[model samples]
Target: MLLGEELRLIAYNTAIKHNITTSMVHKGLYQLGVSGCPWKDADIVEALGDLGDYGVHNLFAVERIARISEVHPYSRVKGLLYHSYESLGVKERDENGEFIAPKLLWKENFFNRNERGEGNAP
Candidate 1:
């Protein structure tokens, strides 16, 4: 089991490398249950819920979103972060039932918006 300080360091490093907030990294680790972390699934769900629409768009935030989908398939998190699902390799279909490639959607929504600083919502 990892110590709290160790976990904090991991979160900090991940935040620095990913260009995301430390809080987001900490929350993601808690959600992922790194080293037997005590945070429950409900806690993770609530944390993600508090992030709102724009917060969910952050690059690091996608990890937590994907974790939620893996643990809870019927979760509202999936619907909330629908666009992110594609980026995380989750399959998505258009209204016409045609496959929508995650790479294209990721480039258009994440990378492009990131270049414009539109994804950096406060």
Candidate 2:
């Protein structure tokens, strides 16, 4: 499956298991500086950690998390994304060059990729 599809599945399953909205998962991801592109395993891990830090536990089964993690291994994606963002000279960072999380903007339709013709075949 495509990475985006995998991510959406993880997010959807996580939200369903936690009885929370998909926006909640997106909020957590946003807080972790995820920009919905070039995802890495670390991004997923950090996003999950952000949710856990906010007391959102048991979002998904351990087996599911493990499977996703195995599929998306931690690599240079974060650095690559950061580099691309930096090349644009965007000032979305602190003095330390660390990215600053953007404000939460919930877009409920983000989870409805199928209706939008952006979904992958199952």
Candidate 3:
């Protein structure tokens, strides 16, 4: 098992090279339970939840991202930032700066806004 400091270093280094953050990397590692792994960019993208240009955040999403990037000695989780921007719809930012998906996809498609029926509510 790697020490916490070692994990931190690896995450920090990866973040610096890939323009991410130690916290993000650490979260990925912790989520995936992968160390000294070998994943690729595609893997990272898929691992990141295949969010389809949406900045939706989830534990599984980030975990998959971390696993996928492990293939390369220096891998970066790309496109998520882009997804974050593209996913932003009507809702700007809540008091906590969280981007909330709009209830209506196109006003008329309110019945199927987020693949969820109008009656759907979590």
Tens-digit lDDT track of model 1 for 1-122: 46678656655554454445667655554434432323454444344444433455344454545444453443444345535555645555668989653221233444566679776322
lDDT of 2 by residue, 1-122 (tens): 23767767777876665445566555444433322333444365444544444454432322222323233443533222213334534455689978655332224433455467865322
Error of 1 at 66 (Å): 1.9
Deviation in angstroms for 46 in model 1? Answer: 22
* Candidate 3 lDDT score at position 75: 30
Candidates 1 and 3: which is better by TM-score?
A: 1
Deviation of model 3 at 15, angstroms: 1.2
> What ordering of candidates by TM-score runs from best to worst?
1, 3, 2
| Model 2 C-alpha lDDT versus the unseen true structure | 0.44
Candidate 3 lowest-lDDT run of ten = 101-110
**Highest lDDT: which candidate?**
1
What's each prediction's TM-score?
A: 0.33, 0.30, 0.32
